[model samples]
Target: MRYAVALAVAMAGLQAMPAQGAGQRETGLEETLAQRCDAAAASPFDRDRPSGVPGVPSHEIDPAIAIPACMAAVRAAPEVPRLWYQLARADLAARRFDEFRDMAARAEALGHAGGAHALGQSHEAGHHGARDLAAARRLYEKAADAGFAPAMVDLGVMLEDGTGGTADVAAANAWYLKAAEAGEVAAMNLLGDNLVAGNGIGRDAALGARWYRRAADKGDGFAMASLGLLLELGNGVPRNMKEANAWYRKSAVAGNRRGMRLLALNLETGNGLERDPRGAVSWYKRAIEAGDVMSMRLISFSYFNGTGVPKDPQEGLYWLRKAAEAGDPAAMVTLGLRYTAGSNVPLDFERGLGWLRKAAEQGEPRAEAALAVLGDAPPGRSACRSVLGDYHALDARYGALPARFSGTLPAFRAVCAGFPGLKEDDVRRCHLLNPDGAGDFVRRVRKQCR
Candidate 1:
């Protein structure tokens, strides 16, 4: 009996030794799979690794390769938070927002701060779902508390803007300072903006310039453009047109639309460099291609005056319409006025009013006032209506002035008296309704009607 028991024990020990060896091999394979996923999907902005070491940009990651590798890694080590986070990043790169959200939630549950921040961003941006600002703010707060620099910066923006809750400028500044101290470039830019604007903080222009320079030195294009602005205007730094233009060129090369536009403006006006209308037009076109609506307007003006290109009113009109179509309220207002005045296009009251109504709906005070004036005029009074619309368009191009007192005063009153139901006092007041007075003017009109 003793021999039989010993033989059974020896067999069990031999079997356990092989099982241990198999377990070690499986562990090594799982690690290799996880590493493959990490290589494919890790973010350049990830704070998990050592500071200042950039990994792959999310856009550069090939989803086809990343997704399969990450899936295998996640399957191999389901309990590893880092693997789950990497898988989430892969899904996000593929624009599989729903899957990314789920995977990010899993990684966040497993205590990955990057996963929490990414999840918060998804909620904030309303990716593949409704925006849940409260949920986003909560997630950002959690990750920020965990010492995540990106989360700290995002949370600061939310608090300052009151996106998910009441505005807390002090708290927002605190978070920005924290992230900035931790070497977050975006936070540095925000800090610079706040200091320059003195928004809920004491003015510190010199300090703001320093903050902008710090981030600009780190290859942040937005900061480079901002610092350039300060230098150009001599706001916080000594006026240095050469340095400012150099920074603007650097920022433009780095793909900043504002930088491109600014560089174009400088070339056109000879502000910081010799006037080069052709170069200005080229830069403006580049900015337009980069999705800058304002550049569209500027380029349209260039085409209208033959500044660099040949005089082409039709091309100018086309660009104006493009800007208006892209939802630029200023462009809509300009196009609406031009249509009313028959400046570029044939006189079309309906089309003009339609454009003005769109701009008014977006809270453009100029559009609202123009609409009010035209609305009171009878359809039969086309000549009177044209004069009113033309004067307003001129005001929009230049700046607003008192309607009863401007160059159009004689015609303005004559038209006011011609309208059957229109009150001259109300018409004049409409012209006075600048952006700051728009709300009060609306309230008074509403009260009068009541």
Candidate 2:
């Protein structure tokens, strides 16, 4: 989620370059030094690694080891563009931005496609103190035209998003196709998304599925999850719950947070697997630990209803508050309602209104609607509005209530019983909006209310 320069975007440009001969150094010594640099800095996406040599991801490159080795290699073969680029990569990993700029510039001047791409990334990320999307795009084009698959993908993204120029969906698709044909997994995944969504590309779900499959086969966890969703919904593939569950499991195991949340939902509901509430909770916890905020909301529900765990209202409220604090608008609305209604909490109208106002500022429709009706009502009318707001929010989120919700209606009625100041108009409004469908109960309540 590093928006400045996404890891995939930065890594996509590290294409391998063949070593060019420098001065009159011995071939053996030059080869030896270049090999050392490659050992420390070869990218996993590099297309031309020596046999049996594994490529390293940028984040995994140890600057401590790579920097010194690449520097020595550059010293030995100053004319070798690859060595200079490798030194730049090591500097980038170490956050030595100025050093990276200098070395990468030198490497690009020496005809290294990866070095050009690196420069593009720096410009795009504002590492030069100001973002230059136009410069980034030009550099990406140069590298992409030179047959660097990662550069092709990055350039496609820029064109698709119109980051530095007019949007060109057709041009973006062409770049994606080129990169995908060259075996860029990120390109394959993005191509699948565009094709499926028909985002200025041809709508071909089956073809999109094929591209996703190819990327998933390359061990892309995000692609695995996308394929699973397609299979689950019969969008691009036939509905196959078992197959979908298998893919979801694979994606989750591979550390995709979306996959983890989806698999947990299926496990909890027995949608595509045997119901295992305990297992579902375990996965939800794992997702939360992985920084997924939605899972916090789900786990809160489990705690509230004692599903797979003891019913602990305080714990449930704790998770709900955590979610709200983390900027979940839905959680903020729910927390606001609970506080205003004094449901498992002390009545604090001002605190509840504050939460609602915060959510409304974020454009949460539910909070906006609730505030519209309840913001300045008198005590009795406010109590009535609180019940209505709580019911509406719940119905919007979950149409069918579980056994745990059975107490909610009775609790609502109790509020009405206590608020004798209720007007006939308030009771009529509640009856009209209530989904309980018990007109007789509403009539009887109307008769008894003050």
Q: In model 1, where is the ten-residue run with the lowest total lDDT? A: 396-405
Model 1 scores a C-alpha lDDT of: 0.77
Q: What digit string (tens of lDDT, one per residue) describes model 1 on residues 323-430?
A: 899997777887887787676789787798899999999998768777776766665555555545544543443231134235443434444445433355645555
lDDT of 2 by residue, 1-450 (tens): 232243333223222334445443356556766787799897655544566778677878887777766776686679888788888888899898988888989889998898899889888988879899999999999999988888999999999999988889889999999999988889999999999999878898889999999999988888898899889878878999999899889999998887887888788768779998899899889889988777777777778768778898798889878988999787787778778878666778788888889989999866776676557657765546555545644533332123324434444444454645345554554454443443644454445443
Model 1 misplacement above 4 A: 1-23, 44-47, 50-54, 126-129, 349-450
lDDT of each: 0.77, 0.76
- Superposition-based RMSD of candidate 1 using all C-alpha atoms, in angstroms: 11.7
Off by over 4 Å in 2: 1-25, 44-54, 345-450
Best by lDDT: 1
Query: Which pairs clash inside model 2?
Result: none
